[model samples]
Target: MSGHSKWATIKHKKGAADAKRGQMFTKIIKEMTIAARMGGGDVEANPRLRTAVLKARAANMPKDNIERAIKKGTGELEGVNYVEMSYEGYAPGGVAILINCLTDNKNRTAADVRSMLSKSGGNLGETGSVSYLFQRKGLVTYDAEKYTEDQILERALEAGAEDVATSGDSIEVTTTPDDFESVLTGLEAAGLEHDSAEIAMIPDTYITLDNDGTRKVLRLVEHLEEHDDVQEVYTNLDIPDDYDPDAE
Candidate 1:
């Protein structure tokens, strides 16, 4: 879990940089459109849509663009009929990889994803291949400086969080998916702010790699994430303990 937490922290920091480039906004809107289309456009009735919209707002996505996405999903306007898909694979060092995508054409997306994987020394697997190695959990991350650990632990436990831990300058709260919103709401009511909150796939076990292998795994994950159709990439790679962000 700690390894997954580190990966998440790095991913979040990188995502913030991607947002500045405006490339990540496309993924956010696609997610919102798909969420709204699957469930109703009403955020109150759709937790997924609510989360997607919240992320978009946090990213400062335009209000009109958000509204237009909802409209398209609700059929108020015609839009791309995206289909949600997940691809399973392995990165370098046998690290399990799960790729989530939203696309109108499965064939094209699959081909592109497969090619990318093959070129990167990975091979797509059958459904449920590596997926079983991961469990869905709600993760909430906070900057440690924002609150005392005792305070966060008390509120989070009282609000149904299963676990809370501090890593460096960050504190992480974990909960079952069913208890996520409730815990988040409780935190909000208590005026606690989180750095990031979302339901994510946590690996059952992680594969540790040396410097070379870690770099290869990271490159493969980064490449997959850059694809326009790819939304999220989950992996079980435990980043090397000696990794120095500034050294790279």
Candidate 2:
């Protein structure tokens, strides 16, 4: 598993707490609304909306909330007009960072992101500056404790997954964006439960930093994620296997 993948697993474990505060729901709602507006509310016909709906279901979002968000997107009910925006930047150790957001006010979101970066010993870069370091890919992770490597390897590849690798305590499945849903469904049908699944901006190369540097970069990431408009934060920082995020 890459450092970012480890971080994602940690975040997934922390998601219940975040969801209790409604932070997770807020982000997912925005994503669903935007997906519906752009691709329409028909899940079977709109791939983007289908993905968003699947994420909402995975998060245990209420059926009523999901329907309302789709309605808002289709203009059946009033909704905020969100625009998708991405920011490229570098963290404390020159590790590349990409922040994806959906917001009604780009100015506020941009300024807030810049402030968070600057305060954390980082700076925003030009549009394509750090983006070139990442690629969009479909990633699905399963708990290593519950599933064997061989079991995942056979089922994942048979379902059209590109690669399956064991990293730390997790099994990572990689796929093209087009095949993500099918691969996920296949795994589910085969009785494999996943920890996290998403279409993510994955870094091509990762940078390893010392403890203090890692802490600083992660602090910045947490702050960005707390913002209402920020949806996802991607970075190239490779966290060491034994590093405990809660240890000072």
Strongest candidate by lDDT: 2
Residues 123-236, candidate 1: write the lDDT tens digits: 999999999999898888888787777888889988999888776567888889888888988987888988878788888777877777777777777787778888888888
- The lowest-lDDT stretch of 10 consecutive residues in candidate 2 is 12-21
Candidate 1 lDDT for residue 165: 75
- TM-scores for candidates 1 onward, in order: 0.90, 0.92
Candidate 2 Cα outliers beyond 4 Å, as residue runs: 1-21, 244-248
TM-score: model 1 vs. ground truth: 0.90
- Estimate candidate 2's alpha-carbon lDDT, on a 0 to 1 scale: 0.84
* Reference-based TM-score, model 2: 0.92
